[model samples]
Target: MTELEQDEYTSACEHALTNSMNEIKQRYLKLNTIFLVTLNAATSGKKLMALLLRRLQKIDSEFLSGLSGLVMF
Candidate 1:
């Protein structure tokens, strides 16, 4: 091939490789964002459950205390 043809071929290959790399990077970023959102949702769910459990425990304690007073009569 002529030197000019070979240079053009190399430039085209470089462009193709760069495009492929950018596509891969974008997919990775999208996946990372999805994973972070899922993790945050799970963490928030756990915190809410813990708060509910604490509230339930407090209610149970008060109910038991009131029952004991009734039994003393």
Candidate 2:
């Protein structure tokens, strides 16, 4: 392939790799928050977690910051 074509291909690959890594990072953060919630639930026991979860539902900040990282593109 010509130099121009090779450069274009390299740029495209770089863009794709960057986008893929960003997506993976976002997903990893989401899963980690999920795991934390699950662990909190398990340790505190489901019933208390259920009650607390309901209470926490109204308070967005507790979990919303973590969620924002996953949502903000």
Candidate 3:
């Protein structure tokens, strides 16, 4: 391959690698957050569990509403 073609291939590979790394990082963070929340609720008792449930319900409702709005478009 010509030098320009080699350079373009290298650039594309780098971009894909960067995107993969970012996705991995985001997944790790989401898992870590869930783990920490579970641990906290386990140690803190029913109050924390209830609070988390309420927050989760609110988030779920909001997410559903957002999806409905998107579907309307």
Candidate 4:
């Protein structure tokens, strides 16, 4: 490709990446807020806290794996 075309392609790719990162950040924040609320509500129950911890660990591993796959791509 020509220099101008290459630059344009790079710019587009960068913009798309930026948008995707922003979306991921927003989603992570929302999920974090929900988790915090749930944790607070479950503070009185040991069983509930353990369950939440397990679920969160599972979700964190899955999220990390998914991110790794994306990075590989």
Candidate 5:
């Protein structure tokens, strides 16, 4: 791929990496509120969201590092 394509790929990857984090936060908070109001069990969903958050954090860090390196060139 050309430099331009690489740059675009890096940017897109960066977005994907962070997108999940945001969704995780939104879902977690929403679920928290729902549980507070309705008191339904959310153990499984919370566990899955936590796992997703951790994985996404790793991906986001890697993507940011790569994107920064590409920006340096």
Candidate 6:
């Protein structure tokens, strides 16, 4: 692809990643409230959300790094 297409791809990728992170953050906050209210009942869900958040973070980092490499060309 041309430089313009690459730039557009990078922007779109970053925007999508940001949206994903924001959604996850909102869900995590909601889960936190539920965990506080229900204690034991929400423990598993909270843990799963935490795990998912961490994995998404890792993926985000890897994705940004890969995109940066691409931009260097």
- Which candidate gets the maximum TM-score versus the true structure? 4
TM-score, predicted candidate 5 vs. hidden true structure: 0.45
lDDT of candidate 6 over 7-61, digit per residue (tens): 9999999997777666656656655654455554345687766766665566556
- Residue 49 of model 2 has an lDDT of 74
lDDT for every model? 0.62, 0.66, 0.67, 0.72, 0.61, 0.64
Shift in Å, residue 72, candidate 6: 25
Candidate 5 vs. truth: CA RMSD? Answer: 10.1
**Candidate 3 lDDT, 1-73, residue by residue in tens:** 9999999999997896676666556655655565568668977898887777666666556555645554553
Pairs in steric clash, model 3: none
Off by over 4 Å in 5: 39-73
Give one digit per residue, the lDDT tens place, for model 2 in 2-71. 9999999999978966876676666666656655685688787889777666655534454466456545
Model 3 CA lDDT for position 38: 61
TM-scores for the candidates: 0.57, 0.59, 0.59, 0.61, 0.45, 0.53
- Per-residue error for 25 in candidate 4, Å, reads 0.4
TM-score of 3: 0.59
> Which ten-residue region of model 3 has the weakest summed lDDT?
64-73
lDDT of 4 by residue, 1-73 (tens): 9999999999998997786676567657755875896688686788777877776776666667656655764
- Per-candidate count of clashing residue pairs (backbone under 3 Å): 0, 0, 0, 0, 0, 0
Q: Could you give candidate 1's per-residue lDDT for residues 8-62 as a string of tens digits?
A: 9999978966766665566556555655555556667987656555655565565
